[model samples]
Target: MSCKYIYSHVVRLLNESDTICIEFEDAMFGRPKSIRLLREDIVRFMEIREIGARQILVYMGHLYKELKKKDKADYFSFLDPGNIPTCPIGTDDRDLSQHIADQLEAVCRDSICLIPYNTGYHWILTIVNEDKNMIHLLNSTSNRNRDDTWKTIVTNGVKMYNASKGISKGPGFKILTGNLKQSGSVECGYCVMRYMKEIVDCDDPQLEKMFAGCIKNQYYTQCQYDEVRSEWSEFVYSYVGA
Candidate 1:
């Protein structure tokens, strides 16, 4: 594929059909620090959608660094088919995330779900019909397999932030793990658009400027595109089957 790009007016695809969707902004460089909250967001989004059982978060842009041959894979973080993904560790974190993502893939197998890499940023594929218990299945073996404990599968959102922007922009993508952001959180995307209308968003200008100055890549656009395609298919399938 030539890698299609998104147009200007893209929006989250939300509606009737088979799935629920969620989005997370990156810190320019992908980071896994938001794992707990990202999980919370997924869990909360599913519960609110009343589809907790079926939904799952897809952590994109997992940066696993290359490890030395002497590096022992003894740690839970180390066992990752990917790596722990330090700004230096991401290559290793990549291997770790893939393993977890695969387990997640296997857990949701036969059911409908998608885990894709776009800009190395995190995106989730949630199936509305599935239940919270189903979501639990992916992690069921974690406690048992302590050595290979599966945490959430986080990949890179996009390298656009890291490659194109200067190093000072940093290695992580902007995290909007909540309705609001931390005082110093990098601002970008809808958050900035919302702030521009001056609609009581937040007083912090730091985030607003960050979001305002950020650039988006084809991968994030692709994720949204695929979501729309999936939703449209489900919608048409509903009427056509009738």
Candidate 2:
């Protein structure tokens, strides 16, 4: 009957089956907002496996909505990672470019945007502060040079958004690397998720300092990863019911 017990039960069911475990209306990308996750998708959080796009999208979607409900996301926006392709090709490239532009235009000029970007091999957190025109890349793997592709994708999107709004060209967003904890091979996705949670939990004034000073080059403890796993399981269980 307790929440912890229910979360454990749901996680057990997720590991045991691969059927659709939960469905929710995700309006993160506007129309066609429905999202369905299979048991395997949810189980990734319950295990030590590399999480896929589904897990990132679903978990962030939940966080975004919760922040909105509490009116705590006024100065920030969370983008759906699915809309931004890792290696966009041909017409897909053009479509995704426009999608990013549209999503950017919806947020205010001086606000921050939290983007969860996945390189084919790992997930990294990209924070765009439009006010300062800076892009902060948080890579848990200590590979600072790994964000070149993401820089290209977002730079193009920002240009397209500016052009559509008839704004003059300016020097684009400056990219900087944050000194975040180094993650293991399979922990990148969870690390990104934890980054977002902590970032949003900070007050507006402390946002810059938290990334700049508080979190140094340290690794997440087992208890920290377990905390994320527990939160993720509870989030899924809310939709799955008893």
Candidate 3:
């Protein structure tokens, strides 16, 4: 995927679940010279060095880290497709990924680390430092689980994310849900149709069943669809006998 798509999907998924996943592209044993060289830069910069040394170190570190990140291709494996965190703009890695899944769960528990995963091994890891108070507070949020506020926030957030399009997906926008087929035409465009399906024990019937049940006689005259014949053609091509 292009970097832009990867980044956008990352933002969407994060806002959706407030959780992150990572994946790796290779086996745990494959170490390239370039990855080693970049990691050296991170080691050198851990403590203060001279100004000139700092500048060179930072630049080289950034270049090397970026190369190592892409090289790991293994990191993208654990995430659901199109939904993985981008390693920080400049980052390097070492042992944090040895048990990537477990470490990410730690990041989830201790820090809000955006992690990458490997079905098998980690390619690299970028650690993010968030406010310690927030971590402590989120950890303490459960006082017998009565406060449903967090769940509401997460649910509404996911809803908006699904409905949105360009840049944060705000007002005047329409949600397009290709996977959901509605019980009735009015409910079809609402986009919450996926959840509605679960309520009905299935909101998604075959496309033909949905259309046959939902379309009213006046639907043929509606301005929104604008191409009744074409719609029918697509529907027939996808389902029903030729």
Among the numbered candidates, top lDDT falls to 2
Instruction: Supply the global lDDT for candidate 1.
Output: 0.24
The estimated TM-scores of all candidates read 0.19, 0.79, 0.15
RMSD for all candidates, in order, please. 19.1, 3.8, 23.7
Model 3 agreement with the true structure over 65-100: per-residue lDDT tens digits: 333555632221111111232223223322222233
Sort by lDDT, best first: 2, 3, 1
Better of 1 and 2 by lDDT: 2
Off by over 4 Å in 1: 1-49, 53-96, 99-170, 177-242
Each model's lDDT? 0.24, 0.66, 0.24
Tens-digit lDDT string for candidate 1 (94-134): 55445444443333322222222111222111111121122
Question: In angstroms, how far off is 125's CA in candidate 3?
Answer: 17
Backbone collision tally, model 3: 16
Tell me the lDDT of model 2 at 125: 83
